[model samples]
Target: MLEVEQKFLLADKTALLDQLAQLGATQETDQEQEDLYFTHPVRNFAETDEAFRIRRIGSENRVTYKGPKRNTVSKIRKEIELAFESGQSAFEQLTEMLELLGFHPLRSVRKRRTPFTCQHQQRAFEITIDEVEGLGLFAEIELLAEESELQEADNAIIELAAYLGMTHPIRTSYLGMLIEKETQSGSD
Candidate 1:
């Protein structure tokens, strides 16, 4: 699947909160997301850029690999099912691989909110973090899934962003940030 997401840097949380309430977009769930970013060698040990996701949004261990489409994913689903049956989740396998690669683990966390979905889904807000706190942070608001949809998710979110006084878009993915920090810290 093609994952297209937009993120923004919120300058005012209080204003955003009020706008969200006015739009009836209540916070769905807030939790700390922790994870480890590591590098490994797969395939020919020369080509693949292997990485491990050691933790996730709370304890919800959902490993999602975004492949193009059906046929490829169908085979993956089978393999994943087998892994679960063997009592070895994908994360467990990944953890083992990372250990073998001589990569030390780096852990981090950030608070995130899972957005609530409703009919037409005219408004939605999802804030997530892989490492909790002021660092490795990001926020998102998705609106209007299809062009034909009557309600616009963006209008509400944009209004909230303005109300919150958003100034810039945070382009760095938390995973990427954590990797940089972990490697830098490791070198030090």
Candidate 2:
């Protein structure tokens, strides 16, 4: 599936939350996600602009692979995700297996996310407000679109962002921002 989304740094958290509420968007689920990123032993994911991540949310876990962004304005990418009902022990075993198969652990990103869903132009969009550990607050508006619905999705994202009074959307991923920060500070 394709994950098409636009991200923004939230200047006022409470005001945005209130705005979403006024827009009649209901909170669907709140989650704390710990994402463990990996790279192939012989390949650099950073250089390739791809990602392989194992995410643990509560007792549920999933592995996701995200292809490189297809465009510069929004995060339009191909994604494959699989979920398992196993607990932490099974997650650990899977991690070990991936390690044995030559995937090296790169970093872990932690965040608290609350997702709200609303309909616009007969299409549903999910807006996720994230409080990333060590990174502060951000908001993301996402619509799952097919290859043919790309333009429609883009328009809807822009309309929604404008409706919410969001300007200056960011194109950088949290991982990239963190990496740049580390580079500037000269520490891992």
Candidate 3:
């Protein structure tokens, strides 16, 4: 599936929440997520614009692979994710297996996320308000769609974002922003 998403830095969480409520959006269970990103032994994922990460939410673990961005306006990419057994031991084993195969841990991104579901233009969009550790707050509007539905999905995301008064969309991933921040800090 393709992940058609637009992210924005949020200035006021309460205002956004009020807008969502007006749209009849329903809240989902909030979650604390830590994503451990990895580097391939032989390839540079950053240069290739790809990402491989293991995300841990409570006891559940999921491994996701995100392909390069397909568009310049939004974060349109191919994403494949698989869930593993839910436990510390299982998570460790999976990490060990990846390490054994030559994948090296890069960094971890932690965030508290609250998600809402709303229907717009006949599509269900997953909107997440994230409080990213060290990176401030962000809101993402995303829709998962088939390859053939890319344009429609992108349009829906854009329209919804505008409707919510989100003017500028940030295309940078949270991981990328964190890395850049760390680099700048180190240089300072």
Candidate 4:
């Protein structure tokens, strides 16, 4: 499926939460997520604009494959995700298998995310408040759509972000931002 998502840096988390409440958004899941990213040994995923991430949230584990962004304005991409109930053990096994098969582990990202959802004019949208470790607060509004419905989803995301008082738009991923910050500071 196509994952149509937009992210912005949140200056005030409380203010956004208040806005979401005013908009009648209901809290969905509040969880901490740890993601481990890997690179193919023979291919450069960064150059190819692809990502392979293994994520653990609470007692569940998932592996996600994200294709390149389809547009310049929004983070619309092709994504496939699989969930398993085996938790951390499965995650470790997967990591070991990937390493053994030549996939290189990159880095791990940790974040506490609380997701909220509301319906506008019968269409549903998800708003996630993310407190990423070392990355600060971010708000993301996302919807899944077909390739043909991307414009509609993008328009909706823009409207929702504006309503929530997001003045600065951030299209970069947390991983990219963190890497850039570290690189600029000359720290690993």
Clashing pairs for model 2 are none
> What's the TM-score of each model vs. the native?
0.54, 0.95, 0.98, 0.95
TM-score of 4: 0.95
What are the root-mean-square deviations of the candidates from the true structure over C-alphas? 7.9, 1.5, 0.8, 1.4
Model 3 alpha-carbon miss at residue 61, Å: 0.7
Compared with the true structure, all predictions reach lDDT values of 0.44, 0.88, 0.93, 0.86
Deviating ranges (above 4 Å) for candidate 4: none
Candidate with best lDDT: 3
The CA lDDT at 77 in model 4 is 86
What TM value does model 3 have? 0.98
Q: Per-residue lDDT of 1-188 in model 2, one digit per residue for the tens?
A: 58889999998989998998888888978999999889888888888889999999988999999898876467899999999766999789889999999998878889999999987779888999999998999999999999998888988898889888886788878888887878888963
Q: How large an RMSD does model 3 have?
A: 0.8
**Which stretches of model 2 miss by more than 4 angstroms?**
none
Q: How many backbone clashes does candidate 4 have?
A: 0
